[model samples]
Target: MMRLSVATLSGLPGDIDRPRYDRAGIGTGVVHLGIGAFHRAHQAVFFEHALNAGDLRWGVTGASLRSPAVHEALAPQDGLYSVVTRDGAAERVQVVGAVRDVLVAPRDPAALVARLAARDTHIVTLTVTEKGYASSAADSAAGYLAAALAERRSTGVDPFTAISCDNLSDNGGRLKQAVLAAARQSDPALADWIEHQVAFPSSMVDRIVPATDEDDIARLAGRIGVEDRAMVKTEPFRQWVIEDRFSGPRPDLAAAGVQLTADVAPWEEAKLRLLNGSHSAIAYLGGLAGIDFVHEVIALPAARAFVAALMDETAATLTPPPGLDVPAYRAALLARFANPALQHRTRQIAMDGSQKLPQRLLAPIIARLDRGLAAPALTLAVAAWMAWTGGRNDLGAAHAVEDPLASVVADALGKATAPEDRVAALLSLSQIFPVRLAGDQSFRQALIDDLALLQEQGARAAFARFTGR
Candidate 1:
């Protein structure tokens, strides 16, 4: 069995697709943080298209902030990997060669900083998730950016655009805040320079890249007759929308199906509230009912109806971008969620609910309240999350709940055994909930009633009642 690398690419079966561009001629102009499955399936794939179109300056160098696992996987292969887009039994396989190198931040922080400082590296992108942003203490991503910008500043190098592909609203603004805060801690002068010169452009990325498992690897290997440990599996659908503002040169990504817009806020809000909001609902409620995969949950009558209702309520709170069809978008999302081949896990999406809920569910809920409307479906989704954070499901089975605020959730659950008291305790955490909504009696009672129903009956019954299915 030959290892999948540039050296082995020629020996690969001619039936498989390889990079169309000259891999040797490509330069590493982009440094991406958190080169996980999602990045490989989304951003890396986009750059591969750009490279194939003769844009040699956009080759990416991926850097890992915490785990060396991704570096270990790709470095051995010379930064080559395959992406399999599955649509039912159909699979489209392409070997992506856009990633020129990968580095572990802990092993060689100076090298990482030097890469960011390099004149060739004009764009810095990140896929670090919502919790990756630092609200209090500095995070690794911010710290690295601060150091890199300091070096670039001292050396008189031009600043690069910082693009955040996270699901958070106004992600660019949020990331800028984190980087500036981190830079300010070391040198306020450097922070001031960064604030004026650098550009943090918010972007929205959509793709269903599930966590690759042994089965996916084996299937891919069977198709290509090679062992590539860094293979990523995703759905056929993909979308990227970036803000047009940039501090320095950037690739013509518009030719690569990327929507370059002056305003990404509308797209971000719709995606966060509708697609992400329903995803959280499926995770908490569906996982509580012992459902494993997203498709399985969406297949259920009650779950499907609940999600549809939830999206409808969320859409009411949003103003769709011009020329966008809200109903079609909703339909497409449901179909995407029901992608049987993807096997997106409920538990995987359920992680980091404490950080995720404020944007995905809470924002829309607050919007409805501001308009003096009751959001029962969104309220039920929150109640399901409360039950999920209780550490046991409706089946009386215990599962480990992974969240940044897991300890706080545990403490909240421990503080009260009653449904009303539990809802009160969780809502009292002003960080997660807005004061107006949390203080609303009707909203609180909606959560309390649903929580009681979920406790007495199972998730299915409660969902059925909530949706009147």
Candidate 2:
């Protein structure tokens, strides 16, 4: 075994074509809050490409709020890593050098805060997932942003742009509200400062970065002939849409094919409602059918029809974003999800249902219902969720569901005393659904009916009934 530096590991023959750039000579200009796989495969790769071309003031400092394993692994190598993109026939490995440091939140909050408040740190980006936003119990991003903004105010620092890569509508505005609330909690003056100084940029990020397994590690090592600790693998396709809202200096991401626009609302809505919504549909419905992987679900006739139908329903409610070809976009999404090489797991997608359901299922359901249309596919997905979380699958596999509201959901399901009561208790959850949605008698009944079908029949059979196949 050869001792390898991060730079050496990244420059192998089959990997990134060049040696890692001398990043120590440049200043750290970006602090990425969540150093997850998607961020590494998508944003970090983009930043690395930009830096390779010319821009040096856009290096990233990886920060994790909870996980210390990443920090420990990358720190030994001076924050250098590799990204491997895989489709069915080809694999490309690139050494990403943009991250200059890795910071664990609790280990050194003071240091993290100092870096955030630093004058040279022009951008603070997050891929902290929807749950990390510390949004209220009622599904809002305002709470987390408020806390971060309060830290900024108490420290009296120059403002940097906060970019959210989470899949949400008006992600930037939601973050701003949270920051302001936190500032207001600290002092009225702090909130006033935030209103004047801060900028929150909404973004839509798309990439199917699956969890790495032993086979992936071996494949990467054999290809590159080096042990790259930070290697991540994902589906070949990727997309990022961002609002051009920045108060300070930022990278020229446009050079790397990133779309920068005045408003990201339309793009966000399209991606969230179509791509993410369909993903949830497949995950829940597929998981309950005993399918283990996303590709497997896509291969199933019922699962495929469910996703396609859901997308069709979603498309009816959404107008294409400016300059986007709706049919072409939908075609690409279908192709991406059906890529067998990705092997994204159902259990992985199935996590955080409480945080995901409202945006991915309920919103579209409500929108369709408002239009006097029935969203049967969406309703079935919701029913699958309730059934999936009700503790046992058809295989009798026990589910240790994860969510802040898991206990409550479990308790409510337990009291199922009856199907109607179960649906009522679940829907009436103000934390997961708006009052208007909870109070909808028709919607409640639909949920009750679908849930009953899911309980009586299996997932595949229930899906068939919902789709009338």
Candidate 3:
């Protein structure tokens, strides 16, 4: 079988939307870090639209910071991959050619640095997730960015905009902080130059991109009549809201249906607290209930009600900016979650609870607690995560707890039998929970009670009680 590449693209079925632009003429202008499935299905789709609209400079050179898997998959195909969007039984496949190259930063950081230093590369985007920030400034994205910015500054080339497509709150500001911190470690002058010259624009990206396994590959092969190892599966609903702050020329993303806004905070808060918080809750509880996909999780009466109630509690802490409809967004999220074709796995979303909890669940939880309001639904999700980290489901099957702090979480749970004792011990870890929030007697008691309930009755019963159904 022919693989999906530039040569084979022309033979693809007409219904499968291959790139309309001339791939041979497209030049790399955007350097993306973390060439994960989410990047391929979401941002790369928009860049393809940019290319199709005849902006040849929007081609991407994606860098996989830790894994060579993406490079190995896409490089042989000329960075060509399919974005398959699922809505019910219907699927739309588009071959995105905007990504011209994939670089493994670990194998050759110098190559990635060279691409970053290139004068035509006016924008750099990241979807490296929350845990990627943990490495020291030298090896992390911050370090690489600092090195690239220094080269650009020395060579008298213009600085590029650094956009963070990660879900963390104020990620743009946070990236700037990390980059400057790394830069200052070597040369204060370089840090100063970055502070003034570079623009770290925050962005809010929303799309449920399921990790493509062998099954998805086979399914896509059956649909497109080709082998695309780098293909990604996603939901039809996608969004990207970027702060309208850039150092120089940028891809006409707005032309491709992006929201280039002045203040990305409101949009960020809405998605993080409502959609993401609900996702975390469902992933943990559904995983415990032995539900495979997100739609199946939402199908359970108890789980559906719990998700609605949880979103309501989280939404209470938000002050959405004008023109943003909170109710509509919440309703849409439930419908999106119930898209049966998406097959978004609960175990997949359940990964990295420690890294994701702060912005997704904890901040809203903290907001409600500080306002003298009970965060019952919010605390229930945290309790689910604690239960998930225990490594065994109600079905008596063991699953890996894939978190950067798995050891620390294990040590925190060490030899503790009682739910209260376990809850108090885990809460004391100030890395995930705030110092004051950890010590708060009311918050501590709530988590203790929720954990006790999960232990006593199991996930479904606990969710029903949490939602008062």
lDDT of 1 by residue, 80-184 (tens): 999988888888888999999888988888889889889899899998899899642333888888888989899888999999999999999999999999998
Candidate 2: segments with Cα more than 4 A from true spot: 1-4, 18-20, 135-157, 466-469
Provide TM-scores for the models.
0.97, 0.93, 0.98
Q: Rank the candidate models, highest lDDT first.
A: 3, 1, 2
RMSD of 1: 1.4
Winner on TM-score between 1 and 3 is 3
- Cα lDDT for residue 207, candidate 3: 95
Deviation of model 2 at 77, angstroms: 2.4
lDDT of 1 at 194: 91
Give me the candidate number with maximum TM-score: 3
Q: After superposing candidate 3, which stretches have Cα over 4 Å from the reference? A: 466-469
Task: Write out the backbone clash pairs for model 2.
Answer: 142-178, 145-179, 146-178, 146-179
Query: Candidate 1: where are CA atoms >4 Å away?
Result: 135-139, 466-469
lDDT of each: 0.89, 0.77, 0.90
Write one digit per residue (lDDT tens) for candidate 2, span 243-323: 987887877788887899998888887888888888888888788778888888887776777778888888888867778
